[model samples]
Target: MRTLRRRMGLLVVPVLGLGLVGCCGSGERGSDASAAAAGFERAISTGDTAAVCAALAPESLSEVEESGKAECADAIPESRLPVGGSVRTVDVYGRQARVVLASDTLFLSQFTDGWKVVAAGCRLRAGHPYQCAVKGG
Candidate 1:
């Protein structure tokens, strides 16, 4: 689809900083990372706050709770992070990944449990790490 191609283009452009470069891992790991991102988006779209919180990396969940001054389940939806879009690309490194979607970019980490989103609803800011609406970054 044209939309999918465009979104993939967005991933390649330097402005987004999510190009699939320097990847050095198995495709299976990349698939897992993408699946994790997809699940996170699905949770957000469904308003399953508990599921959303569960998909977040521990530190990110803690930050979300602290920012909201509420429990993670209560805070995740209140954060209003962008979610629910087709995955355009997934770049995986050692225990880390960047999942690019039509609406947002998510940074994830592989934990003992699985891949977890460490940052979501992210935007590149030239000289800094992607600034995220919900971040432990």
Candidate 2:
């Protein structure tokens, strides 16, 4: 009986350790997503084009810049930006994560930098998607 109890204890210790590790990892991911969302909100509020651009994905930046409709440095109006939203849910796989925000708009992509806004507008469109656009610096 003593030997059986000892063996169970050993198994329990490893299971508890693994559980702790999993919780820590999940917490870190949540913190990252929260920080990214907060940064985006703050940048938009302050009209910090640089901050906003920095948070964007590389391909997105290039596409917006090349389109010529708007530049990355443009200040986004308060109306166009999200006011309050929490990370409703976050799905992560490897270096990428997709976070669902509580705002009216929907942002896509699994970003290592958390959930950055890939696209936003009153309505999602195919060709002419509405996002923060700025002209020449």
Candidate 3:
């Protein structure tokens, strides 16, 4: 339990440098990114490990597995990620996107398959990269 809690803290404080700045509703890109982010959020909130793992980018999934020293299914449930509300904003730049919900922020990237989450449960810190609870190394 103590180790799990410590890992969660590490997740929250890790810096992710994605220099994205813009508003939501940029057309089809925004919609797709928002949809992917919403699906990830929903999966996490509902404790659907399969869906959650599927929604994650490969690197993000690997990071979670490595950090927790467990499989994605067991590790994700222990991360204690925030449950997001309705999509409030979505900013897409090229293939990268950020989706801001009522209570959470997520970063995603477009892949051949579709948009997959790169980071989740992120909080902004002035003059720094986002601090995320789930992200790639």
Candidate 4:
């Protein structure tokens, strides 16, 4: 009986350790992505253009600057992205995320620093990707 119990303990310990390792990274990443999305929404509602610009991904900031011939901080508010309601849901996959608000949809990407907004004020189009007022492209 003692030998059988010891064998079971060996199997259980390794299984439990692997399970913990699998969950730890993913759980933290999901929460971090959601917080970044919520913070972006708050910046828009408060008319904090600088904060909004800071929340944008590098590619998105470049797109804004190139298209408007203005700095990202100056151009972000001028884009007039729809101010959606509170965040309803955040979905994360690998390095990408989608956040749904009451009146708008936002896409985000994970960077070395953290998550950043890649698109905002997006609407669905038949058989196409979302059409966004502010997008990385």
Best by lDDT: 3
TM-score of every model? 0.81, 0.51, 0.82, 0.76
lDDT of 1 by residue, 1-137 (tens): 01111232132224343444667334899999999999999988888888999999887888888988999998777777876498988877677788889989888889999999888888766754456677772
Number of the top TM-score candidate = 3
Off by over 4 Å in 4: 1-26
Task: Estimate every model's Cα lDDT from 0 to 1.
Answer: 0.76, 0.46, 0.78, 0.71
Which candidate, 1 or 2, has the higher lDDT?
A: 1
**How do the residues 1-137 of candidate 2 rate in per-residue lDDT, one tens digit apiece?**
01101131121112222223223325676567556756665676677878877766665566446654557675344225454455565543344333445663323344554565554332323443323332111
Task: Give candidate 3 misplaced runs (Cα > 4 Å).
Answer: 1-24
For all candidates, the clash counts are 0, 2, 0, 0
Residue 95 of model 1 has an lDDT of: 77
The segments of candidate 1 whose C-alpha lies over 4 angstroms from its true place after superposition are 1-20, 24-26, 126-128
What is candidate 1's CA lDDT for residue 75? 74
Better of 1 and 3 by TM-score: 3
